[model samples]
Target chain A: MSRRTSRWSVAFVAAVLTSGVGVLLADPHLVLLSIPAVVFAVYPHLTRPPAATLEIERSIAEQDPAHGQEVEVTVTLRNAGDRTLSDVRVVDGVAPMLSVRSGSARHAAVLGPGTETTFSYTVIAKRGVHRFEPATAVLRDASGGVTLETTLAADTELACRSPIRTLPLGHTARYAGSTATTDSGSGIEFSRIRSYRPGDPPGRIDWNRYARSGELTTVSFREERSRTTVCCLDAREICYRSSGDDSVHAVSYERAAARELLDAASDAGEPVGVAIFGVDFTWLAPATGSHHVATAHRTLEDPETLPIVPPTEWDGTPDDAQARELRTRIGPPTTVLLLSPLLDEFPLETARTLRAEGHSVTVLSPDVTTAGSLGRGVARLRRENRIDALRRAGVPVVDWEPETPLETAIRRGERR
Target chain B: MTGPIAIARRLLVGVGAVALCLGLLVLFGPPVESAIRWPWDDELLLVAFFTAALLLASVIGPFVLIDDGSQNQNQNQNRNRNQNRGNASPGAPERVPSTPTPGRELERVLDSRWPASLPPVRRRRIRRRLRRAAIRSIVRTSNCSKETARERLERGVWTDDPVAAAFVRAGGGPDSDSSRLRSLVERIRFPRRARRTARAVLSRTEEGEHR
Candidate 1:
């Protein structure tokens, strides 16, 4: 529409005048000008009129989304223009990479001038910033004639980077290496002995000294240190993750779960390491550290490649070899937290390999069953039994049905 | 927007069109009936006169009044004055009287079967096209066209387009012997009528029409 802009403007004027003047002059020779005019006429394809002055209001169903919860994003497009529009297409740019599960997010509506069309499209929330670009609005004249494409500038962006659920650490270890006398919680290592306070636990009373001094005194012990634990993430197949609402964006949730897990482990003074597997032709092995956490955070922000690589023509198949390579690199005695949609075999072997290596394996398999419970019912049950078989082989498994919170999974783990 | 206005306009337009058609038949249609024997004397002169009258009426018939309980007496006059600018062509100068330099040119050549002399229009377009071809030959000399030719030694895009290469080789653009030999190669590849895109992008560093 650049140089053609000027030519088209001229063509429009020339076409009408030449045709009008030709009829008046009764001269068909003016039709020569019609040739180019006809070509220009073909360009302005018919589309809905621009929503120049449109009032757009958007809302989500709830404030919070459980692990794989699906939320509906109701976007009401009010055509404030004083003109009728045909073939209106609306795409709600949701956070992360969750696609519309059930409802038609893209719509073509016929609205009279001033009337509004309310479109409801369901979006299952994933982790990260889902910035909504202004809706692309295209309006064409009735004859499939002049068409105008304008971006509705009044776009609303909603971001939801929810924290992954973490189980309460079996133990919290402390490290100070301080010799200074201080009154604190007791450990096997002696911290300090101070005058007993009323609320002091009877176990730390030091009975012999209490009788001798005739006054209450408590002996505090120094906090202990345990082995530094590393939690390596097996996140190669976030793409195939499907939710209870049949959303593929559940991959971001798995990422959020990974990040939240690192935070919980770090809270317990466990050194955490994260690795994002199955990215590209060369799978990246981001070393574990505070920096690794930040890198993982950045990777988690995008549901797709995390800008790890520009999108190529991906066949949408899992990288099994890369996953195996990652499985082989697990640090000894590290807690292997593997998350997947269970739609493939790469993740199953990863957890099995970790368990076989004698590392504690915790599997969070997000179920991506088919819709209507027809073909998915038997298949989903069989996969659950397969995970149970893994658990019997000495791996702790967490059944992650989409929308069921991580807390529910944790409680189930605890019962097991 | 309603049925009445739409219906009335339809009727008026329909009636006017019918009247115009009948007038056309009387005027433009051949008067074969006048040649045949009939109840009344079929005079050739009379038929010709009637036909002329019909022609006159056909011209005036449309300008005649349309009756939909409304007056279109001044509609044509109003349209003539207000003439919808949206429908009319604008008066703008042709930009890129040619396609953008050599890429488009190469794409065009590859897409379409090679042809003879390019369309003629503005002198600037032809010059621009040649310049673009020269630049392409000079730049992509190794990959695009033969680099041995003097013109190709100068620029490759020009040599890439068989027609432009020949023009430059036949002592057209440059006067070198190697350039002439390169021109020979161009003629062998392209027909006399078949034209290649001119990739004239040398004088200007900007990306524009090239062969």
Candidate 2:
């Protein structure tokens, strides 16, 4: 919109207007010719669509799904104007980690009467805060007139979390006197009490009970440690996506859970560790102190590229040696919390193996499998089977669909 | 290809548009000659409408060319590739940007040949993505034929997208696309299946008992 004056256009217009009276007025031929030329050449730019007028909205068909499932995205295109929109194409900019299929971004539509059109597509996200930016609708007149580009930052987001596991924490691990043990040393609930054994500790002995029992019967109350387990998410390109500017719900979601878990653990002073499975493992050995929790957070935050040594349990290759080596090098097992999409068998098997080795395993996998309408049933079945196996193996499971609050799922499962 | 199709189509739509515009123009334009009256010189009006229609189309000719978005695909891919790789730290040459990577010692891609000249930033991005993709592809790929590997790539099945996109985008210049990258990844000299098989066999209990 520099002045409506091109030098030639201005000169021509000036000649037509200021060429005073008789002789110029006589030659009206020039005026008609000039009008059509200018109109034809300049109409497009003048008629270009307004950038501010376009609005976009997006909805995730299912705000939640199992890992590796597809999620449908329904995008609404609204014309907030009096102008007839032609050649309006809308592309919902997706995060790089998602796989989008079907149809082109450039929609062919003639929306004139306060119109709204919606385009539906599907994608499978790993796990995390999946942001949906505004749809970029590139509008041009049917005659390729001035092209107008609109960017609507609608700020739509969907949070994908893992599925629930039925097994309790004790299923993942075992305690000799767990039943009457009251499991009080560190857990989420109150179990029970037990009689003093031969090696009764004076600190834990119920003095009141001792006075009554006529013997030193140590009062063993179930230890209620924080159900806070922080996972260390590996955001490095290799673990999930390979390149730069890539995002996977698995990476982001795992990182997100890890962050929350670490925060909760830190506040509650519980042990936390993360075994990053990328090219290798980035192990933050489980420690109970708040400092260790902070370390887990920092490790999760590290900008990815660092070489990671994966814990042996989740090794992609059927190589148990690595898992054996990791197991040997590791200290006392805390809860083995695996935050992944579980696209492959590695993470699941890792959880199973951890349980087999006397470690409590909790899997937080974002349900990518049950995202869309058609495949949801099958995905649900698969998810059910996975949960069943973990439960049968005595590992507590928490199945989460995307967009459902992770905390709610964790609490419900624990209570159950 | 792009504009004026609507207007042209409308006019040619028989009585609906032709009669409308011509009726208006004939009622309005200055008298050409006595042969053409102010209101109802049917032949003259027809001629005038046709002439105007031809003139408008001829005037709008050049602008009709549609610039298919294909032209910009390469430029976008290259720019993104570089932006991604440059973000990785220098010390970790094989580092992928987002999903984890820290491991002790591992076999590098072993590319002694200097890669074709590319913008340094883009090259770095490609290299990083390639490294990450290589590892991930190795992990994801079952020990199968080159055809199977290629099929997986074509399906866009890998979990690591940035690396895959970069690898695919970087392998071919303007001529490259996702399909092309899929093929190239399959052909990448590493016998990825062999390594995986070796690792698996070495880990198997049967083999372990012998060891």
Q: How much lDDT does each candidate structure score?
A: 0.48, 0.47
- Give the range where candidate 1 chain A is weakest over 10 consecutive residues by summed lDDT: A1-10
TM-score of 2: 0.39
Which is the leading candidate under lDDT?
1
Residue lDDT tens for model 2, A208-307:
8777876666554456433323353433233342222232434655666665666555544555566665544566666677667667656664544222
Stretches of candidate 2 above 4 Å error?
A1-37, A45-51, A68-71, A125-129, A141-145, A155-160, A165-230, A237-416, B1-211
List the candidates' TM-scores in order: 0.43, 0.39
Model 2: CAPRI class: incorrect
DockQ for each model: 0.01, 0.04
Q: For all the models shown, what interface RMSD does each have?
A: 23.6, 17.5
